[model samples]
Target: MAAGTYQNWRDVADLAMDAIAKDPDAWGDAGAGKNCRSRLIYLYNRRTGQLVRTQIVIQLSAHQSGKSNRIITAYPRGHQC
Candidate 1:
């Protein structure tokens, strides 16, 4: 993996913080204190040359059934998805 790649678990945790700071509403019921896992998604827009980094969090539930998972989302400097 490349340096600063989001594929790793630690990077995901670090990016989650940035996501929290970028958009708190996407956090849903899971606040920063809650146990969560995140994935980093990159986007490109016509208006800008740089790519936008987005963080998506999967809300951990105790009674989650198979395929029935809870997820929370957060984005940085762009429209909420």
Candidate 2:
């Protein structure tokens, strides 16, 4: 899960789910995980529906042994490299 105020967002969970449903825009080898998937998703605040935040969801990799892929983190897109 994302740290700071992102966790408190009303649609934080939804954003993560959406990311999994969408095709990753970019990816790379994340070492032990085999690969990393980066997707863009939007999170909205509960009180204000107009409040939208763009986040990048990095999934560790596809399932292996029936286990689902794990999300490394979600952070504001374009805010960092």
Candidate 3:
């Protein structure tokens, strides 16, 4: 039931954890000061039951500030935007 809303959070967490474990210095150190956000995209095939999930990591610009930098702030579907 939980998977209906957010499947890629767990998947992406595992992937990110594994990535950090493999090379801690590479991923963490690179995006320290940078503003970043992660979301999920799901893809399914009609021929197979398996679902393909991916993380959409967006790099926000420094100029986007004052709550305007948030995902819902500029998203077309969001009411706050």
Candidate 4:
């Protein structure tokens, strides 16, 4: 996936982790599937230099034994929730 305004994959991961850590309740149904989850977070856009609503999606590995959860995608969704 394209990093877009993000510096790199690590940058996106760090922001997503921080958001989840700060407010666990922010995550909700992503509707991608049973194992997928999504969260809307306000994050700093390095290009815009503004705080924007970003969407972070993660897929749980519940169906895959011994696998870990992984982020599926992250992007700026503007002000929409």
lDDT of 3 by residue, 1-81 (tens): 124334454554454434333433222111424433333333343346567443333223232443323322111111110
Q: Which ten-residue region of model 2 has the weakest summed lDDT?
A: 72-81
Candidate 3 or 1, higher lDDT? 1
Off by over 4 Å in 2: 1-14, 62-81
Candidate 1 lDDT over 1-81, as tens digits, reads 112342455555545555544544432333433433333444333355455444444333222443323344332333322
Off by over 4 Å in 4: 26-38, 50-53, 59-81
Per-residue CA lDDT of model 2 for 1-81, tens digit only, reads 334333554467556656654767776665664556667766555455544556766655544564546655444454222
Worst 10 residues of 4 by lDDT: 59-68
Clashes of each: 0, 0, 0, 0
Give the lDDT ranking, best first: 2, 4, 1, 3
C-alpha lDDT (0 to 100) for residue 27 of candidate 1: 26
TM-score-best of 3 and 4: 4
| Segments of candidate 1 deviating more than 4 angstroms | 1-7, 25-27, 30-55, 58-81
Report RMSD (Å) for each prediction in the order shown. 10.2, 5.0, 10.7, 5.7
Q: Rate the local accuracy (lDDT) of all candidates.
A: 0.40, 0.56, 0.33, 0.48
User: Of the candidates numbered 2 and 3, which has the greater lDDT value?
Assistant: 2
Candidate achieving the largest TM-score: 2
- The residue pairs that clash in candidate 1, if any, are none
